[model samples]
Target: MSLDTSLLPNNIFSLKNDEFFQIIKSLVGEGLCEILKIQSINSAENLIATDDIFDVFKYDSEELIDIKNKHFFKLQNGQYLVKTGIKNSLLYILKLLKVKKEEQESLLNNNNHEEQLDTKFIINHPLLRSLVSYYKYTDHIKNNNDDKRSFLKIFIDNIANNLSQSNNHFRYHDSVKQFAAVLYILGGKNPGEQKTGKKTS
Candidate 1:
């Protein structure tokens, strides 16, 4: 489904720019991309428990337990819903790049590092390549940097493109746009659209 844009929060971009980057950094640093890859394989809407998550990402059992306690996974009808959001979408892109959380964190920390982000993994990741190509086409108005793109732009474009391609009944471009609206609100930017005033069906 296409997003109306008018159905999103007005203050979705309220976060400071640095805070936005920090959120992105934390998501990448904590292996969120790997988690998202697993989720994508299994189906995003499928209710999965901690055991399921552990099997995919191999995160420490203790940490998984803590995440459960934090209500990251919502309980509905005795089933735990997998967490879904922009962060998960961004991580999925990173997973396609074969970028480890450590590597992403290191890059975030040292913006001036001469090392280049390896795109070799993209050769084997057709879907990721497609999504990245789509993102660059739709999001970039002008080419300022050489071959590199910012993590934020990549994240947004990937999510937008992925949502555009989703065939699932519950997954739609509008949902992804709403997610972007939330990010903008958190980042202290004034989102253009107003709330839908109606609950999501």
Candidate 2:
């Protein structure tokens, strides 16, 4: 069936401007991605216990409730029917990455072509989210190893072209300034003086 964008779940929307992204923020890295992938395979059941998911993962009620209001329907028995349509296409990509057995820069950048952010998908894409979750689960044995950090460094390096300050990926200082500006305004300092941190007597 062809996807009508209007009918698809909020999970597939751009994270930069989507409120659903913020609501589900608590679930990321806590196995919400894993549960979604598992549910994607069994299109028949379509139901899961959020409470039981904490058996292997962890979450508080508020975190669960936040996503529940948006991405799940509460059944009479309390199981959640996932509202997201995680199709076979996602499963195929997960399987393909499994076959690779290691991170590949080929998935990162096309050196033959110019890099452009507007022309490409954001880092929060469901597709990339699934692949990252797949690699993380597969590499569970090395979770605490120093090599894992090295692996991340290598992964970042592989896509470093897109992570530059010019691309809005690695402008750590700008973010710091923005954060400081918020604090300065909250402190009731003069806007011009906030930049220089000077006091006028």
Candidate 3:
């Protein structure tokens, strides 16, 4: 008997900006990306939980070959976009990460498991809120280690700079602000800043 792969579950994808932002914020808020393990990506059962939530990325049947090649998987047109195999793998990884973070948080009461934050400073700043949300929600979905590290550096720099510029109350003076000192490091171009303009040489 031949196995029918089409009978399997498909995890969905969404491309809407609002939905994208919502997913991004939720992942950052959950804090799973900071501690998720690579091995969890292989968990099969985790793949099933995302079946309904993953179908947001639909495809054009006219471009079936190109879509399959670009997405690195195959799927039938009109099938809920989430149930395809490659998407299933991605969802499995995300679901496993989400569950793992929840487990970690539950173990933290009266324990030193949670990372310490300076409480005297303003915690309700908009950027800070965004950062915390991003940190928590992206915990499960950010799978690239290098990308995560880049994100962490950018996140820290952005938060520190915002706090410093908002008011003089928070102090990090005398300490070198290599990344935060210049706007260029964070990829912003100042009015008088020179632009070399992407020359490979």
Candidate 4:
């Protein structure tokens, strides 16, 4: 159970061990505390870079995964909305109090387990995915029937077809991106590389 956010007391000494964990949990639940290890990131930071996205999942902590689903953490835009005062207040308490020896041993053991699960850090970032998908499309096209059209032309044509399929119902501004996504298919560099992926809506 979490500590009631409204009923917080000022004195850390007054809280029990479980209550301490509860406060920490309230500040940043589950494995999110491990995020502090990555370049000493604090919970209050507003933006998370693409490269650092993997670090957030580096440990594959089930706790991290659980809390990540909370609406405040918008992984889609690489924005994490941590609660106010988390860094200067309760998080400082974590540093102030020494962990029990048994808990320390348990954490070390968990770290070893986390180290073995490398798949957690594999990012679903845009550039990597675009490269992968583009290459796969090229490989498939190359292996099958010959086509004279260039890769850029082929993908651009595909984009055009998709746009026309909806009778150009997509808004003019959004259609701009729908058309632009073809350049990623044809190996364009960093056209708003980190976020927007819209097949529809």
Candidate 5:
């Protein structure tokens, strides 16, 4: 039971311990204080109520199985994975901030900058454009099972090459390349690498 300090006198020394404890029990009901074992010295301890405690066996057995089943659901689809890889690849090209870009020279020359250049196109850089192209190509090959693994290897290799051209780009790029390599090794074959198995999605 938590006591309201305001209920007690500002000078606690004025009241006896017994008087303070009686006032505490009166403010909060009887059993509530019994749930907390208050000592004569004003120090209290919680006594775990063994009689009213819940038993583990009281829950339905099916509830335990339902919890175990939830672990099997994961989000890793081929199209989504490819899209994510392209996004990560684009991050290496430039520092993309939330700020929007606008045409400066044309706007200064005349107010009609809209006729000369698309304002939204200012955000498009070479690297981002390349990544967008790769993402679209990956989506295009969704049904062509024959060369899926090859497609992924080529995509990852392209990113790795791009990283190599820039200063220490491959440092972070190598990790992604390694991931792609692992996936390739673990039944991650190109379109023609494996002929017998069902195609990966």
Candidate 6:
């Protein structure tokens, strides 16, 4: 079924300039990380060109051109680069995911059961799926004791800390909460009740 864009806020397409930049930066960084996993590259110093970033994200030429025109990306001497460092890039992605999760929950709450199904499909869009994949990859790294595991742990801790500080009782989408559950299972424990912060085996 097609997604119901009408449910989204009108500002969805016209995000603040800074917000738009951060989203694209985060996406590019995540895409590069996936490419590094595929190529077995351990060093972050190796610069990724525009074509490589596009390939990793499976973006067609038209999409690439569109993104460039939107000023969310800059191609410098044929290489794609984010002004924000990798850590910030990752944090931005986490922030974006949190926003999406809350948005999805709000839509579900205000809609009928039949309409909620359409909301679920919209929440499963490719961009969110890619974020889920990134988290899954991080979980794998943590499990296997990879060299990058320490960095991934720090990233997760940063996200958790931020969430704790927000003090907002966000109702995340079911799939997003399920992903959190999977991460907990990978860490050898059952997931807690997210709202209550209590766990049961």
TM-score per candidate: 0.20, 0.22, 0.22, 0.19, 0.19, 0.21
Decreasing TM-score order of the candidates: 3, 2, 6, 1, 4, 5
- Model 4: per-residue Cα lDDT over 18-108, one tens digit each: 5544554565564444344332443222112223333454344556654544423555655555434433443443333323323445878
Q: Of the candidates shown, which would achieve the greatest TM-score relative to the real structure?
A: 3
Which lDDT tens digits does candidate 1 get at residues 104-127?
457666764433333656657898
151, model 3: CA deviation in Å?
A: 48
Candidate 1, poorest ten consecutive residues by summed lDDT: 41-50
Q: How close is candidate 1 to the true structure, as a TM-score?
A: 0.20
Q: Which stretches of candidate 4 lie over 4 Å from their true place?
A: 1-63, 75-81, 98-201
- Using lDDT, rank the candidates from best to worst: 6, 4, 1, 2, 3, 5
Please write out the lDDT profile of model 3 over residues 1-201, one tens digit for every residue: 233222222321322233333343343432222112111312333333435332323444543434334443344643433224544445554554455444545766525533334332326476666766666666666743665566565667656776657576544433234445575555755434457655344
**Structure candidate 4, residue pairs in collision:** none
Query: Global lDDT for candidate 5?
Result: 0.41
lDDT measured at residue 199 in model 2 versus the true structure, 0 to 100: 62
Candidate 3 global TM-score = 0.22
Clash count in backbone of candidate 2: 0
lDDT of 3 at 4: 29
The predicted structure with the larger lDDT, 5 or 6, is 6
What does candidate 6's lDDT look like per residue over 1-201, in tens digits?
233334334444445344444434445544435434433433222222122433432343653554334323456655454434544544544444446556766876777776877668758797656656777786765664653655555555556556766558544544445667889889876566554556545
RMSD of each: 27.1, 23.3, 23.6, 24.3, 30.9, 26.3
Task: Say which prediction, candidate 2 or candidate 5, comes out ahead on TM-score.
Answer: 2
